[model samples]
Structures are given as C-alpha cells and as structure tokens.
Target: MITVKAPGKLYIAGEYAVVETGYPSIIVALDQFVTVEISRSKSYGSIVSKQYRDDSVLWRRQGDQMILDNRDNTFNYIISAIRLTEQYAQSLGRPMELYDLKVNSDLDSPNGKKYGLGSSAAVTVATVKALCQFYQLPLTKSQLFKLAAIAHLDVQGNGSLGDIAASVYGGWIAYRSFDRNWLIAARNQQTLTQLVNQPWPHLKITQLTPPKNLQLIIGWTGSPASTSHLVDKVAIQKSRQHQVYAQFLQDSKNCLEGLIRGFKDGSLDAIKAGIKKNREILQGLADFTHVPIETPTLKKMCDIAVEHTAAAKSSGAGGGDCGIVIIDKHTNVDSMIERWKQNGITRLSLRVHPVIDLNKE
Candidate 1:
C-alpha cells in the first residue's frame, strides 16, 4: 500500500487580485491534511471516502481511458487525478494498473463542516501524489504542483491555484498565479499529457520564511464561505468596473510586497502597515462590488485583535469563514483568545505545515 498526504492552505494576502496576471499572493500550508491511500486490487479500481460513501466510483481502464461504472461524479477531483496520471503514463509507454483507493481528510469537523482551509485543493494534491507514488513516477515538486493544478482546474475551471501550490510545496510562499489564458489555449491545442509536460514560465512560487518571533492566530466564524460564488461576483463587477479594479490591484500588490518584506525583516510596524493597507483595499473592493466580503463577525474579530495590538484580516474569499491575525511572539495569546470567545468566535489551533519529499521518506 502507498499513502500520501498534503496539507490544507490559508491565504495570508492577495485573494482577488491574484486572479489577474502578475499579481502575487502569499499562502501558508496548515498542519491539517488530506490523505489518500492506494492498495493493489484484484479486478476493478474503486474509491471509498467518508465524504463520498454514497457516490464512490468503481472504475477500470478501457483502452487508455478510465471508464467509471457508477458515474455519480461526486469525486471528480480524484477521478481527474487518476485520468491525468494514466494519460501521462501512457505517453511514456507505460499503462496504469488497477488499484483500490481510500481518501480521508482532517480538514473538516466530524459533522462535516468545512473550515475554508482549501480542503478540495489539499485532497486533489494528495490524490495526485498517491497515484504517482503507486506507479513509481519520478516527478519534481514543480511537476507535481502542475499536475495537481491541472486536475483541480478541471473541476473549479478558474482559480489562482495558490492553494494547490501551498499544499504541494508547504511552508509560507509568495506565489504568482499562472496565466489562465495561456493554460486554456494550451489545453485546447494539446492532449492532457502534452499540456502538463509543457513549460509554464508565468507561474512563480518562492518560499518565504518569517522570523521566529512572528505568530499567527486563526478564528473560525462557524460558517463556511462559497469561494466560487464570491469569485464569480467579483468577476462580474470587474467586467464593468475595470478601472476601479485596476487601481485596487496595484494597491494590493504594493501592500502584499510590504507585508512579505516586513515579515522577512522582522519589522512589526511595517508588517502592521501592510496588513492594514491590504484590509482597506479589500474593504474598498467589497463596497464597489456590493458583496459582503467582510461579515460583521469578521469585523468584530479583527476589531478585537486590533484592540490587543495585533494585525488581523479576512483570510480567504471571505463571506463567513476564517480570519487571520498576526502578532509578535510576545503578544498575550490567552487574552486574545478570551476576547474572541467573548465575541462568539471559535479559535482554531493551526500552524504552518512543513513540506516533505514523499519519495525520499
């Protein structure tokens, strides 16, 4: 049996702006993970997961194509990974073998409430890694990232892929989104294997290690946010308010750069300035688009964090999910947690997850 794990992710900055070309986002891989296990099977391949007990697929290879018997389409992420891996193997004159797979996630509550920690991206990365390991495919971290991204984009259709990059590489990273137009054009012109094998120069991921004196706290608002719906709303607004969005994008880039620079140099004041500036830009975007990207609860949480002399902002495509706070290591965390609980916010115990080379391990 082969087991693979990938960490969930949180966006520290550059949420909407990263969708456009050249804008960069900072993302961190969380300690929480999604795991995929693969074992040799006798006749057919099947998937079983706590999230998809009712919608599992019993699949088999039919002349270079994976055919599903059930066709429920619930686990498209897993299926996409399998399909892409099979095609890549075939391109190298190696056919895929059948296997039984099981997926499990620690990204959700036992009751199945998602934490907006990039669960889908994590699972997609895990599945891709599991398949490659099972087949003994030698792929570098960048190669694995691109392969997982292809499978993930097949489902969501549009995203920055920061989450997938974080899951694959781990640690804190400054990532510029890939050129979606270029990727779409390439997909139209080539097979899946050919598309992944091509060079992608636009995507840039750099590991950014913060000072040891830095600290982060995540607070869950007890509600999940639909990132796709929020992104769609912003896209519609961007179509009409192109100039306004263009200015916001520029300001966002500056703010994100300042944040990373400050963190790297251990300048608390500079980091605070960057966090506040970025929050203001997001607030402006929300007002311009008439979307409640920052909910009342998120506002309250940030307000409380500020009262404690820490910097805070909404983490992801925030309607209502998690908010992040940055502080010095000497900040009184207990006091902050008490304030959050008083305001009905749930504190989540999460930290940065380190990346491991699975093949070496």
Candidate 2:
C-alpha cells in the first residue's frame, strides 16, 4: 500500500483577479490535509471516502466523460486525477493496474461542515502524487503540478488553480496563474507527455519565507460556499462592467506585488497594509458585480480583526466559508476570537504545512 497526503490551501491575498493569466496571488498551505491510500486490487478498482456516507463508487470512462457507477456524485476531482494521471503514466509506457483508492480527510469539521480549505484540490494532488509514486515516475514538482492542474481544470473548468500550486509546493507561495487558453489549445494539439514537458506561459510558482512575527489566523463562518458559482457570476457581469473588472485586476496585481515584497523583507506592516487594500479591492468588485463576495458576517469578522490591530479579509469566494486574519506575533487575538465567537465565527487552528521535497513524496 502507498499513502500520500496533500495539504489544503487558503488564499492570503488576491481572489477573483488571480484567475486571469499572469496575475499573482499569495497562498499558504494549511496543515489540514486530504490523504489517499492505494493498494493493488485483483478484481475491480474502487474509490471510497470516509468524508461521506455514500457507498464505495466504481467509475468508468465513456469517452471523455467519467460515468459514476453509483448514485452519489462525489469524487469529481479524484476521478479526474486518476484518469489524467493514468494517461500521463501510459504516455510513459507504464502499465495501468486496478487499485483500491481510499480517501481520508481533515479538511472539514467533525459534523461534516467544509471549511473551504480547498479539499478538491488537495485530493486531486494527493491522488496524483500517490499514482506517480506507485508508477515510480521520476517527475519534477512542476510536472506534478501540471498533471494535477490539468486534472483539476478538466473537472472544474474554471479558477486559477493556485490551490494546486500550494498543495504541491507546500508552505508559503507566490503563484502566477498560467494562460488557460494557451494550455487548452496546447493540450488539444500535443500528447500528454509533450504537454507536460512544455513551458506554460505566465505560469510561475515561488516559495516564500514569511517573517517570524507574521501570524495568520483563520475564522470559519460555519456556512459553506460554492466558489464556481461565485466565479461564474463574476464572469457573467464582467462583460457588462469591463473597465471596472480590468481596474480590479490591475489593483489586485499591484496589491499582491507589494505583499510579496513584504514577505521578502519580513515587513509585517507592509503585508498588513497590502491585505487591507486587497480587501477593499474585493469589496469594490462585490459592489459592481453584486455577487456578495463578502457577506455581512465576513465583514464583521474583518472589522473585529481590524479593531484588534490586524488586517483581515474574506479568504476565497467568501459568500461564507472562512476569513483570514494577519497580525504580528505580539498581538493578542483572544479578544478578537471572543468577538468573533459572539458573532458566530469559529476560529480554525490550522498552521502552515512545512515545505518538503516533492519528488520524494
């Protein structure tokens, strides 16, 4: 049996704008993870998840579509990971084998409430990592990220895939999204192996070293959100509000670049200021698009953090889910937590997962 774990990610800065190619975002890998365990099976391959109550699902591919053999529609990203990873493995002349893939997760609360910790991305990365190890494929981190991103895009069909970078790289990262149009065009014309080896335009992933005093805190609103729905709504409105959307992209890029500088210089103040500006930029987006990027509860969470001498904002698509707080290590967050508790926010205890050698996984 081979087991691999991929850490979940939280977007520190830059949200909607990061979807554009070459836009930058700062993301951190949370200690929470989705673990995949695989073992050879003689009969038929099966996929099971302890996160859901549904029975083990058997999957089959009818042309490009993955047909689930069971009623539950879960395993969307996992199935994609398996299919794409296997395609890459076969491109290398590796034999495919049936294996029972089991998934265990710490991305949700005990009552099964998701925390918006990028569980789908984590599971996809974990599955890909496991299969690569199984096949003994000597792939670089970039190659692994490419395979996982391709798999995620095949299923999601949207988003920046920054979470996949965080999962593959771990720790703090500055990620520039690749040109999806270019990737899609290349995928159609080139073999999987050829595509994997090609340089993805505007794609860059760099590990960051945060200052010692920089502290990150997470607060869950106890309400889950659909990132795709939010992103879809924003995309629909962008055509009508092209200039505003374009300005947002520019502002977000500038803000994230400043934040990256802070990470490099170990300046907590610069980081905090950049985070505050990014929050306002997202609010502007919400106002124009009317997509409710930051809910009333999330605003309250951020307000409380600001009152406590910290910078805060909604983490992801942020209709609900979690919001992140940035504060110095010397600051006391107990009062902020108390205020959050009074306002129905639950603090998460996740920390950054340390970076490791990806090939060894």
Per-residue lDDT of 1-361 in model 1, one digit per residue for the tens?
Answer: 9888899999988889987777888899999999899998867889989786777778887766777898566788888888777667777677668899999999987778889999989989998888888887877888788888988888998779999999988998999988888887887888766676667757888888777777878999888899989999999999999899899999999889888888688787787778777889999999999988899999999989989988899988999999988888887788888988998899999989876565652
Candidate 2 local lDDT, residue 288? 96
Top of the candidates by lDDT: 2
Candidate 1 TM-score versus the reference: 0.96
Q: Give the poorly placed runs of model 2, Cα more than 4 Å off.
A: 59-68
Q: Determine the C-alpha RMSD for candidate 2 after optimal superposition of all C-alphas.
A: 2.0
Q: Candidate 2, residues 1-361: lDDT per residue as tens digits?
A: 9999999999999898889999999999999999999988765668999986576787654543445677556888888898899888888888777778899999988999889999999999999999998888878889989999999999999999999999999999999999999998898899999988878999999999999999999999999999999999999999998898999999999999999999999999999999999999999999999999899999999999999999999998989999999999898788999999999999999899989587555
lDDT of each: 0.86, 0.91
- TM-scores, in order shown? 0.96, 0.96
